[model samples]
Target chain A: MTADTVQSGLAAQGYVASPDLAMALHLALSLGRPLLLEGAAGVGKTEVARALAAWKRCDLIRLQCYEGLDAAQAIYEWNYPRQLLAIRAQGDHADEAKLFSETYLLERPLLRAIRQPIAPVLLIDEIDRADEEFEAYLLEILSDFAITIPELGTLRATTRPMVILTANGTRDLSDALRRRCLYAHVDYPDAGTELQILTTRHPTLNHHLAAQVVGFVQSLRKEELEKKPGVAEMLDFAAALAGLGVADLSADPAILQAALATLLKTQSDRAIITTEVAQRLAGKAA
Target chain B: MRGAVTRFAARDPGPAARIAGFMGHLRANGFRLGIAETETALAALATTDCSEPATRRALKSVCCGSAEDWARFDAVFDSFWRNGGRVRTKAVPSNTTPAKATREAEGQATSGAGRTDASDSQKDGEADTGGEGRLIATRVANLRRRDLREVVSADDIRLAETVARRLGAALRDRRSRRVKAAAKGARIDLRRTLRASLSTGGEPFRLKRRRRPDRPVRIAALVDVSGSMQPYARPFLAFLAGLMRADAAADAYLFHTRLVRVTEALRDEDPFRALNRISLLADGFGGGSRIGAALQHFATTHARTHVDGRTVVMILSDGYDSAPGTDIGTALGRLSKRGCRILWLNPLKGWRDYAPVASGMAAALPHLDLFAPAATLDDLAALETELARL
Candidate 1:
């Protein structure tokens, strides 16, 4: 599909994609390559996978990555307890082959995605958190769309799943992992896009309130705070204001300060975003 | 068809030259383009009309393997593809209006017209500047290819420092085998499983696992600063300083007749300040070369703790041992057996058909995985490429 269609399709699923991201997604789909997205935390990196899955009406298989994430967690594992029970029950008559077969196998996200009748959207979130060896191990799966189990031999995908790998730029990924994927960067959105997203995600929020929230969050991102608020924060703040029966962000500084907690998570960040900064930002136009 | 072909040829150069120039610009501006990306880009262009906006998007999506490359690719693509059309359309005669001609000339400059006819531009520049530009260019080329031991000018040393700084980030990291308990791991932690079984009446319900620990690879560089190595010492130290700056975990030692840890002194970002501090701390500077004694010192003090299987130990010297009393071979053998990969960089390796004939070099050669020249920038680039492969 063309980039315009990709953009419109994602919009249908409530994802406001930038032109660059739309083009990247289109190319990734056309070329049948994994789309690797690197950005700061909570910039809708994982949402792209969700939107793509919703757009295609396919299963979204998510594999949350962390340090020391290995093939056992990502692919498959044998049911050790079940095997023990079988050993006890059969008493030397237990079939070793059947115990280690698909009957006793527990499939993880990677293996489940591979065994799907139709291609699913496989989201490997925060891939930079994984170790380099795990990244290297992904080379075989990414390149050939297959995995080798010592007992089961090689399991190739029935249908090649659309893979989306997201990174928060915590560490550098291996060159081998990078080479097998198409790349895109999703940074913080502009005030206009954030406002649009705010209004779209929270229709109960008025334009003035959405603008004030976007302006406050955008200004906060520029501040020397530990954690910056994302689009999700804007949505949360809007929801908080709507729940508090505040029609406009032109409310009192005290009310705005209390509502700001829904956006800023950290204590230091909340301390930094005082009533004065919030009032000043809320008064300004987006 | 013949008329169409002639018109195409008249309006534009072949795609190969244009793509080559674009790729060259990307490389010069620090965009890492792999061979696979280049092949994919070519394949994409073959099946699509490159002038279309969709094709540019497709090309960019395939060509950029990392997010860092996207911004640069966009800038170059916007300037190059658009300017290609503008330049071709504005191919006017010299007798055009002066204002229009000047505007076209400005456009040519922005479009990198000089790079398209680089030789002609160089000739024209030489004629205009009267040999000064050509002289500087020739000197720089010679300095880059010449041995570091023969460098005399301060300008050449400064230029080498800049190149060495760029080469610092090219060192590769090694993975470790030590495992730690993690949320997602390969092997089951039987100990944890047994410990948890007590809570479940000696029957474990959930399985705990362990994963291999990841550590940043350590680099320990031993630079010779004796009288024989005096000429090349500053450049090599600059290279080591750059490496230390790129990797904070890297260790540096300066050895003449003795080994001295200069990691603190060389931590200064300013090359001049770091060099001054190094000169002050190196009391044995320009003294008699003693590779054997220095190796023995490093082995006895720091080898057991710092140098390990994941460590890459680099020894930069001319390999001349003034005092042969201490055994250099034994120290190197111990370091090698400790799992440290030894890489020996000799400044005289490429000069006058040189060989490892020096006593110290011959002894260390058996323990070395890489023995390359450290005499020129090109040699350093080659070393960087080798490290990347490792």
Candidate 2:
């Protein structure tokens, strides 16, 4: 599909992707390569995968990476309990080969994504968090869409899944992994995009309030605070304001401070964005 | 006349030739675009409707690898394509030969450093008298091996920081408390074994095993920022910042007469900003060296929570303590007993005839697990392998 098609598709899925991002995603799909999305936390890198999955009408299989993520956890594992049960049931006539068969195989996200009859969106979320060794294991699967199991030989993908890897820059990802994938740097949305996103997500909300909310968040991001309010946080803030039946941001100072609980994640962030700062942002937002 | 005619023809080259020239320009700007990336970009261009903006975006996705690359792509792209395929004198000077530009680019790319600013190179160009390109190449090579104390230029400091960051990335984590699946391990993985037993009708045929997980190394660095260490402190702090980036559990403290925890300050993504924050926090930075008192303070107050058996306590100091007779050994002994590895990195240790003549150095030397030189970027880089072994 064209970049415009991808952009429109994402927009339909309520993800207002930037032109650059849409281009990156389109190129990734066209080339049939993994797309590596790197950005700060709360920038909605994971949301892109969900949006793509929704757009494609495919299953979103996510493999959440952590420090010790290994092959057994990510790819596949043999059901040892099932194998033992079968052996016991067979009563010394148990076949060794049957134990490692597909019936006893527990398919993890990676394997399950590949083994799907229809191509799915495989989201390897926060890949930088995973160990360097774990990344080495991913090289084969990423490049060739195949996994090598000593027992089963090599199991290639029936339908090549669209792979999307997101990293929060915790550690420098290996150059090998970077080379194999198309790259996109997903920053926080701009004012216009944020307004579009806010209105798209919350259509029933008053247009004036939505604009103010977007404007306030944009200004708040410009503030020197840890963990600037992301789109998700802005949406939450909007929801909170709507739930509270607040009209103007500048009108309810106490309520604005209270509603900031949805936006400000850290104690320092909350402290930094005080009632005065919120009101000031709201005043400018008008 | 033939060479001139070829140059004239090359000025109005084909699309493929233009792309090849663009890739070369990208390479000169440290874009790490190999044949594979070039092919990907070409394939992207072929498949898509090649509008200028669309082509730029498409090529960017294929060509740019890291965040640094993504940031630099537009400038490089615009300079190559928009500027009529002529290499900007600012980027690759008109004066510099292609061979020299390629060598400099290779040096910059392989160093894990970001692109040298055009202005910085212009300054370098202005400074050099004879064999300018060779001098630039030699300078890049020399920066790594040069003493941090002798490193005066801001450019050298930036390069040092980049090398330090790579060194930090190389620092491997030791075995952790968490267990991972293993072929043969001391601990029995009951969860996996029981899960596996399901196929064999309630009979445990396979005993699943697990070993301790390999987690990132926890570093607790106590850097001396005293008056005596003024020349070395900045570079060492940069190294400490690298360690902090590599290991989330890493803690940094600046020590002079008093000990101040700069871990929070150093967590800032921008190294310069982190250093700026640290400068503000380090109240008595240029005071007399009091290694013993600082160690005592750390051991008594901070070590209990921050230091564990797996922690690597890295002390970057010359060991010229103002309080020589005070209890450095006692504090180090306490940390050592807790099973933490204490590494004493003295900048002065790089001297050929260097001895632990200083009373503080002599006193603390016996307590150290590893006492090595931290005089240069190369010396710091060597610690990666040393740390991995530890």
Tens-place lDDT per residue, model 1, A107-191, is 9998898889989999999988888778887777888888788988999899989999998766557766777888887879998
Q: How does model 1 score by TM-score?
A: 0.60
Q: What ranges in model 1 sit over 4 Å off?
A: B1-21, B42-52, B84-190, B193-237, B240-390
User: Candidate 2: lDDT over CA atoms?
Assistant: 0.75
lDDT of 1 by residue, B1-390 (tens): 233211234656677656665565444333456666766666556654444576667767776665446644654465445432223112222332443335434433422211121111111111011112233432322111111221222344465556555444455443457888876788999999899675444788778888885666678989987667766654676576666665676788877666766765566665444544454344435556678867876875556446777788888989899766337887897678778788888989878789887777888888889888887555776676777655
> What are the DockQ scores of the candidates, in order?
0.21, 0.40
